[model samples]
Each structure stands twice: as C-alpha cells, then as structure tokens.
Target: MTEEKRIPMATIGFTTEDAREAARDSFYLDELDRQAEIASNSIFHAIMRGRETKNPHDPRVWGALQNTLFATICIARLLKPGPVREYPGLTKQQSQKYADERGEKLRKMLDVEDDCHILDVKAVRDAYEHYDEFFDRHLRDVS
Candidate 1:
C-alpha cells in the first residue's frame, strides 16, 4: 500500500488572541463612529423641530440636544489618550505640563482650527471624568 499523505495546517498570520483583540478593537471603533453619526443626526433633528415648533424647550428637542453633547464628549475621549493617573496624585502644575505637551503634539497632528484643538477636547474629557470640580473651577473658561 502507498504511504498516506500528510498535510500541515496553514498559518493565517495572526495568533488567536491577536485576532480576538483586533476584532474587539474594530467593533469598538465602529461603535464609536455609529454613535457619533447618531448624535449628529439627533442634533439636526432637534434643531429642525425646535425651529418648526418655535419651542426650544420641547422635551424631544432638549433630550436630543443633551444626547448630542454627551456624544461629542464621548468622541473627544476616544480621540485623546487617557489620563496617566486615575487618582489625584499629580500636582496641578505637573498635570498642566503633561496636558500642554500632549495638546501640542495633537495640534501638530490634527492641524485643526485654533478653537477646536486637542487641548480643548482634553479639557472636556477631564470634566466628564471629574464633573463637579472641573465644572466649578472652569465653567466660564470651558468654551
């Protein structure tokens, strides 16, 4: 009888964990994009309905507006890196220094308008992370 032929399994290039992680990352990125699009659509609908009814305080309008802001904050968080420390371990000066350096790098990369710099987005993310304190401290300057 002829010897039986043997075949080896082929490598598809990625390990199992690597493939899983890649799939998770893709899902996360896609979800973020989906949420951003929904928020943008909500904003348009809210404004249009408010204008038509001449009632800016309508519940749907207000709810949609709030969701839009929340989604914007989420997008900002996704764009920038997370804080180095979760707790308040760093001094105010050190925190500011870190933010400045990061902001500059982001600005150079984005090349966006001055008002919409990464630093501004980072500030919003910080507020969401520490809402009460940050709001009180920089309410006027948050714009």
Candidate 2:
C-alpha cells in the first residue's frame, strides 16, 4: 500500500532557505526600480531636450506622458512592500515646483533601498537611444 504525501500550502521555503521570498521581493524591487528609472529619465531627457532646443514650451508637450510615467512608478513603489505607499501624485502647480518635486522623489528612492536607483539604466538608454533620429529630431519643440 502506498500513502499520499501532503504538501503544505503557503510554504515560503524552496530548495534553498528564503529563496522564494528573495526571488519574489527581487522581482518587485526590480519592477519598482524599472518604473522609477523610466519616470525619472523620461522627464529628465525631456528637460534636457528642452534646454537643447532652448524653448520654455518644450516640456509642456511631454507633460501628459511624464505625468503618466510618474503615476505608474509611484504605484509600483507603493506596491513594493516598503515605506513608499503614501507617495502623493504630482501636484498641479503652476510653477516648476511640480517638476522639481517629481525629480526629487524619483532620485531619492535610491537612498531608501540599496538595489534601487534614480532611474533604470537600461530604460534610460532604450528611451534615448536614437532619440533624436526617431523622435523627429525636435523632441516636440518647446518654443
């Protein structure tokens, strides 16, 4: 006669101790990091392109996309099982305060978590790679 072996549900253990937890946490952490980097670099590049274009209106064109990225990253940060849950959405300020605040929050995440960064390096490179050639070489002119 053969008896069936019952496996416990919700078991966090794998072949290695804490390996599952580490892998899960690492996945979320990577995602949070990726989202943050994309948000950070998107606007940073937009701002830089604005400067290169020498136009005050350049960034305005990217406002919506920037806002979306920030919101998405903020959500990812909140979901990462840490102190980032209360992240406030970008404020609707008339001045540059909104931009400044976004930049500050995005960069500051690196200090909170060791494996995190101001922006995802790959996302930044991918975002800007051939940016000029593919983006009409104008980056939606500010002026």
Candidate 3:
C-alpha cells in the first residue's frame, strides 16, 4: 500500500457563551428544518392517500392534511424573528408587540410582498390541536 494519506484538522476557538449561543441557534435551525420536512411529508401523504381513496373527505387524508397544517404553523412560529439563544421575559402584551415588530422585519427580510395565507392557518391548527375544547364548545352551543 502507498503511504497513508494525511487529513488536515483545524481548531476553532470560541468563548463559553458563544458556544452556548451557537448550540441554541443550531437547535432552532434544526427544529425549523424538521418542521419543514414534516409539512412536506404530510402533504405528500395527504395527496397520495387522497388519490388512492378517490375521496377528499377520507379521514386519513384529513389527518395527513391536519398534520401538514400543524407543521406549517410550527415553521411559521420558528421563523418569527426573535433571539434564538434566550427567551426574553416579557408580558403577554409586550411579547405580542415584539413579535409583531419582528414579524414585519422578517417579512421584509424575506422580500415577501404579500401575506402568506398558510401562516393564517394557526386558527385551524388550534382547532385541530384542541379538538376536545372545540367539541365541547359546539356541544354546549347545540344544547
């Protein structure tokens, strides 16, 4: 055998805080990617299942679609501009204000001229997430 090939290695240095911050950012980015994958997979499943059943109303199709919507909402939340490393303690109103500001900035940064309607599906996502509450409210109204 010829002489063994040598591999090069480099040392990167960072403060402890920088390392922690990088880890947090990595986690957030990974989560965003995971949610995106989930949304993509769920939509694909929904389409395939819907075609196979020839029924848009099929429960399995609906389930997959719901998953897609939920995952999309999670992605939207993850994209909300904010500190990735730490949760800043803020009152509900203040937090909402901050989010709104950040959201506008994010939209501008992404060059999004029009609102993404899919992000508005948070209400639908909530309905699916809290189905029991939805059912109870409807049952009460019916009674």
Task: Indicate which candidate wins on lDDT.
Answer: 3
Q: Which stretches of model 3 miss by more than 4 angstroms?
A: 1-15, 81-114, 126-143
* TM values, all candidates: 0.48, 0.36, 0.56
- lDDT per residue for candidate 1 within 1-143, as digits (tens), equals 99999983433346598786556555546656776797789899888878878665698887787677677766555444345443277786677666555545444444634556532555555555686875688786766
Model 3 TM-score? 0.56
Q: What is the lDDT of residue 126 in candidate 1?
A: 57
Q: Regarding TM-score, does 1 or 2 come out ahead? A: 1
Q: Model 3's lDDT to the true fold?
A: 0.70
The lDDT of each candidate is 0.63, 0.52, 0.70
Candidate 2 segments whose C-alpha is farther than 4 A from its true place: 1-17, 54-56, 59-72, 79-143
Model 1 regions more than 4 Å off:
1-17, 81-143
Q: Write the per-residue lDDT of candidate 3 for residues 14-117, one digit (tens) a residue.
A: 56877865565566556667888999999999988888997657999998888989788776775553333333787666777766665565456555444577
**Model 2 TM-score on a 0 to 1 scale:** 0.36
lDDT of 2 by residue, 18-108 (tens): 7975655555456566665666667677666666765566655366356545645454334332222223653344224544443445445
